[model samples]
Target: MKFLDQAKVYIKAGNGGPGCVSFRREKYIEFGGPDGGDGGKGGDVYAEAVEGLNTLIDYRYQQHIKAKAGVHGMGRDRTGAGGADAVIKVPAGTQIIDAETEEELADLTEIGQRVLLARGGNGGFGNTHFKSSTNQAPRHANPGQTGEERTLILRLKLIADAGLVGLPNAGKSTFLSAVSKARPKIGDYPFTTIHPGLGVVHVDGREFILADIPGLIEGAHEGAGLGDTFLGHIERCRVLLHLVDGTSEEPLEAYNTVRGELEAYENGLAEKPEIIALSKCDSLDEELEDLQAEPIERATGKDVARISAISGKGMIPLLRQIADAIEADKAAERGKDARPEPAWQP
Candidate 1:
């Protein structure tokens, strides 16, 4: 199936039923009073998040959705029937936003989550409601209210525990394939990966999800190459694994280029915990690998790991480091949520 993360749709709720205006007539009765009934309510529009859906591609073909209108009221004090509701099913992690104002309406991160997009109109009142001592013979009735309409935007952001990022040909796909069962296309050319891919990584008898996104080039934030559109898939990751090509002539420049793009994106991605590694070390000698990692380590103020997916060198340590970082971040998040609320004060 084609992967679509964004979609635009229009929705409208049902209109309320109109009230009836009638007078009761009985045999041998000198005078008759009004006996009209109220109208039924309209149907509502709702958005529900469900599992087994990872893309918004379904909305691409269907753009407009509308609920059924309520039936009109009848004479003899008979009320109208209510309209049926319209429900939209979307994938988990889908966010609904206003198409024109870009205002966030709802965020569904879990399965079975639901939000009301548009409310139905209220039923109109009948002439019986207006009957009083001053006006015993009422003849007027209220009209049905109109339904609400809106244009919405649906954006999907994938949730994962770890994300792989770097420049083109930086061995991200190779690394992902080496660690998991996912088989992403690998080539020596740039932009081989046109979309984001997810994999399940098992380390230390524990499993966690990992994501690999398209590589970043210079001026990516300005729409240079593939842009940073795919970056949103990893915004929820706990940690990022940055793979710098060890065999590249200008390794430090390549490292800094990817880092610059991340900072420019400005989605708290730059501040996320990252583990820098010199990939494809099998092609480089021990002396050259040490020399290539020195500048990166000095600039980042942390030790740089060396790994070669082909030779399985440093594989254990790399997976261990990633797992450790993920566990630590999870712990910190739990602690933050467990913190007690401060005592209330004026």
Candidate 2:
């Protein structure tokens, strides 16, 4: 499926039915009073979050949504049928905003979460509604109201366990392909990855999702070199995989440059739980690996894991280490004081 993170749309609620303005015109019934019924309510428009979806591509083609209108009222004090409500299903983590004012409408975080956007108008009154004790034959009524319409924006942020970060051609795409089933375009040049890609890795009967974010460059926070656009996707990740290309002329410089961009864009991004990786180790000789990764580890105060994607050298150990770190982070997140009952107490 084509990935679409952000989209614009217009939604309209159904209008209410008009009130009835009929009178009893039967034989020998000259004293017929006002018999207009109340109008039906209009339909409402709601958006709900659902599972098994991670894109907003559907909204690109269909930018408008409208609810059913209510039925008109009838004579003999008969009310009209209410309009049918409209339900819209969207992917989780989709943020809704009002297009006119650019205000936030809703942030759909969990599955089945819903928010009503537009409300329909009330129905009009019939001529019989004006009947009074003094006036036996009333002849006045109100009309039905119109539904609400507004433009909205929907943007999706993919939730993941870990996110890959680096500069363009820093081997982030290569590393993800080697570890999981994702097939992102990889070349010897820069700016290859245009969007974020997700890969699922299973270890010990447990599956965790990882995201390969587009590479960052200097001044990325200021809209330079892919900007800080894809960084939002990593805000929810429990851990980050910061890859530094081992073949770079200055590996430590490459690491620090990306780190500066992260901190510039988001204050706490630099402080997130991260694992330092020295990619393309197979392309370098043993002596070069020492010069590339050891200095980087010392400079960044992180143990840089060296791995080769093509030859699969040291890939398993790297993945296992990542899984361990992830487990440890989750454990710490729950805190040590979290008490539980026996396993089979039930």
Candidate 3:
């Protein structure tokens, strides 16, 4: 199936059932009394985050979802049956928004998280309620209230600990394959990866998920070079593993190009915790590798990691560095949680 991270859809809740009016009589009875029953409530529509769904392609084709309507009420005080609720399974990390207003509705970050999109309509009153003390016989009934409807937007963000970013053929795929069991397609040409790929890096009894986003180029923010659509996949990443081709004509230029695109696309994306690396180090010698690190590190104001995805050199150290960054981010969040909130002043 094709990967779709964004989708727009319309959802509707079930309508309530109508009330029933009837009269009961016996062979010897002279008069009959009103015996109307109330209708059942309508069904609600909800979206749930479930595992095994990694894409929003299903929502692309089916844009409209509606729940079943409740059954009508019966006579002799027999209430109608309620409508069955509808549940749509969505991928984890899906964010629901109001499509028309662009307002955020819900952020489904964990598995099995559910959000009610539309509420069911209320049931109507029965004719028996209209029978009052003033009138001996009365007949009246109320219609069921309508259900709620809303247009929604569903966006999927990749929830990974570390994200891999680079220009095409920067050995990102190779690095992921070497580190984890994920086998993404690899090629020697540009744009080898058309979609985002995921892998888990396990080192020293510690494991973390790594995502390989498609290569980005200059002018990516202005809809150039595959645009910035895929950038959302890495927005929630705790740390970024920047891969620059070590053998490129100008390693620093390659580094700057990808870095420039990141800053242009998302505000503060460039400021995120990042671990820079000179990929494809097998083609370079020890002297060149040592010399190459200084300028890259000095220019970016960050240390540069060296690795040869094919030869497996520097893989362990690189993985350890990423793990360390992940742990530190977690620690910082914990520290924030430990801090107590200030008391409100009168």
Candidate 4:
């Protein structure tokens, strides 16, 4: 299936049923009073996050979603039936935003999460409600109110524990394929992976999700070479795996270019814990690999791991490091959640 992360849609709630107006008639009765029943309520519109979905491509063709209208009122004090509700099912991590104001309405990150999009109009009153001592024979009935309608924007962001970043042909896809079962397209050219791909990585009896997005080029934040549009997929990652092509003429420059793009992008992506690695080290000897990694290590003041996805060199250590980082992050999050609340002051 083609991956679609964003879509625009219009939703409308159902209209309420109208009230009924009727007069009672009985044999041998001198006078009969009004006996009209109140109308039924309308159906609401809701958006729900469901499992087994990873894209918003289903909403591409269906732009408009509408609920069923309520049935009209009947005579003899009979009320109309309520309308059927409309439910929109979306993938987990889908965010609903108001198209006009660009304000976020709801962020669905878990399965079975639901949010109300529009409320149906209320049912109108019947003539019986107006019956009083002042007005003995009230003949008027109110009409049903109109339902609510609005346009919405749905954006999907992939949820992963770790993400891969680097320049084109830096071996991000190869690493993902080697580590997990995800079969992303691998090519020697730039932008081999157009869309973001996710995989489950298992290391030492531990498993975590991994995401790989398109490679970033110089000025990627400003619409350069595939742009930074795909960067949002990794915004939720706790750690980043940055791969620098060992065969490149200047690995430091390549690393700096990707770092610059990440810093330029929003959401504290640059501040995330990062693990740097020199990829395709199988093509280089030990001395040459060390020589290529020296500048990057010095620039970042961190030891760079030499890895080759094809030959599986340094793969275990790299996976172990990623697992450890993810575990640490998870522990930190649990600590934050477990913190005691401050005592209330009088």
Candidate 2 vs. true structure, TM-score: 0.89
Distance from true position, residue 117, model 1, in Å?
A: 1.6
- Rank by TM-score (best first): 4, 3, 1, 2
lDDT digits (tens) for residues 1-346 of candidate 2:
8888999999999998988878887789887777888788899999999988889999989998999888888888988888998877798888899999999999998998989999987888876777878877777667789999999999888888888999899888988887789999888788899899999987666678889988999999999988998888888788898888888999988988999998998747787888888888888998889889887878868788888888888877777777887888889888855866669855
Give the per-residue lDDT of model 1 (tens digit) for 1-346.
8889999999999998888898888888777888887777789999999988989999999999898877777777888888899988998888899998999999998899999999888777778889999999899888778888999999998878999999999999999999999999999999999888889999889888999999999999999999999999989999999999999998889999999999999899999999999999999999999999999988889889999999999988999999999999999999999999999999
Off by over 4 Å in 2: 26-30, 127-130, 332-346
Give the alpha-carbon lDDT of every model: 0.91, 0.86, 0.86, 0.92
Model 4, runs deviating above 4 Å:
26-29, 343-346
Residue 26, candidate 1: C-alpha displacement in angstroms: 6.6
* Predictions: Cα RMSD each: 2.1, 4.6, 1.6, 1.4
Off by over 4 Å in 1: 25-32, 343-346
Please identify which of the two predictions, 2 or 4, would achieve the higher lDDT against the true structure: 4
- Best TM-score goes to which candidate? 4
List candidate 3 segments past 4 Å from native. 343-346
Better of 1 and 2 by TM-score: 1
Q: Which 10-residue window in model 4 sums to the lowest lDDT?
A: 68-77
